[model samples]
Target: MELRNRSAFHEYFFETTYVAGIVLVGTEVKSLRAGKVSFNDAYCQFHKGELYVKNLHISDYAFGTTQRHEPTQERKLLLKKKELRKLEAKIKEKGYTIVPLKIFFNDRNLAKIEIGLGKGKKLYDKRETIKKRDVERDLKRYVK
Candidate 1:
């Protein structure tokens, strides 16, 4: 199952994106496969030179045993050292932050997440985005 954080697109202008593997527990994997995840207020952070995603809610598996995983715990992300350094450097700059864009399973059945380096949008920018979307929808409907 592929899940996207649509609100992230509305709030930030993404400059670059990276697909990284996630560190998940047993129940977490099952929950993800079952599409029981939420990206509310989820974002990425750097800790001790490693990348980790915080506030990502992967719900508990319905049939899981008593040893359930925490839904909003911080989870590590796997990426190359070079890429991590690049993201870290960019994050050090003003107005640059890391946001979780989407999550999907690769062909190998491994869970992966797309993270983006983005800058927050201003009020007018957000309005323009909404206006553009409305225009596109109207145009598509007219053509159909």
Candidate 2:
């Protein structure tokens, strides 16, 4: 199953995207398969030369035992060293953020996340996007 953050497009303009592996406990993985995950407040942060994701909530498994993982924990993200360095440099600038766009299990059954380098949209930018979308919708409807 794939979980997507639809609001990402409305909230920010994505510059580049990369897929990264997420470190999850057994319970977390099980929960993800059941579609018990939320990206409402999750964001990627660079910490001590490594990248970590915070506020990514993976609900506890229904059949979890006493070792259930916390719902909201800082999960480490695995990315290549060169990519990490590149992201680090870009993020150090103002207004750029690393945001999770989606989460899905790859072919090998491992959880992977799609992250984007984004800059938040201003009020006018958001309004412009809305207007553009409205025009596109009208055009599509007329074509049909």
Candidate 3:
């Protein structure tokens, strides 16, 4: 995995997920392979009937020329019409959001992002998750 939004799991309960292709420039792809990406504060939104991810940061490739792509540009996401419509419907629901969960390369060496339709978790729910994680960590240490 090139990048992950760990906060997404803690802040929201994912109800649906979709694997979408990201449009990228050459330098951006190189940066991804070098593990220089951040999904923090990233989100998906529809513009002119197309899905795009905003605030995703793919750092410039170190060896790139002056044509290096911007790190925080809005990138278009490739999804089928049916999936897009489904997501649009889900998003229209109350308290739901679309967020990028992780970025990775497929067998064809193309970049893809796994985005989720999630509902924001309550404060108590977040605390519960933290407690569960701590318990799991303790259990692992005990086992070892």
Candidate 4:
């Protein structure tokens, strides 16, 4: 299956449970099925005791006209109340965030989003991650 967006492992220090859900809107859902979505720079926020994803871009359906939904509008995330509370607690900690790891469809033909509770990485941390990946790649190439 094709994944819409994948969070960088090095950039995210931690990950929690994976949840699945359906997204609202007609044109938005159609656009998502077409893989016309981007999760980069997108994150979740708690508003009025509910979770909403912000900055996520779901391109307007090609056939949709001016009535099409906004590309960067906040999208609601469906999760149980218990899960929402847990996420809210975790987010209260310093430097913690919720990021969308991937968006895909399951066998039942429903759209699902995989979200991760993540911690931001510093500049040097990201550089180190790149360096380690390069070393691993070189080792694998040399082993052949």
User: The CA-based lDDT of model 4 is what?
Assistant: 0.82
Pairs in steric clash, model 4: none
**lDDT tens readout by residue for model 4, 92-138:** 99888888878877888778888889888999988998899899999
What ranges in model 3 sit over 4 Å off?
none
Deviation of model 3 at 47, angstroms: 0.9
lDDT-best of 3 and 4: 3
* Better-scoring candidate (lDDT), 2 or 4: 2
TM-score for each prediction? 0.97, 0.95, 0.94, 0.89
Model 4 collision count: 0
Tens digits of per-residue lDDT for model 1, 1-144: 799999999999999999999999869988988889899999999999999999999998989998799999999999999999999999999999999999999999999999999999999999999999999999999999
Task: Kindly state the number of residue pairs that clash in model 2.
Answer: 0
lDDT of 2: 0.93
The lDDT per prediction is 0.96, 0.93, 0.92, 0.82
- Give the poorly placed runs of model 1, Cα more than 4 Å off: none
Count of clashes in candidate 3: 0
The Cα error of candidate 2 at residue 62, in Å, is 1.5
Candidate with maximal TM-score: 1
Looking at candidate 2, the ten consecutive residues that score lowest on lDDT are 24-33
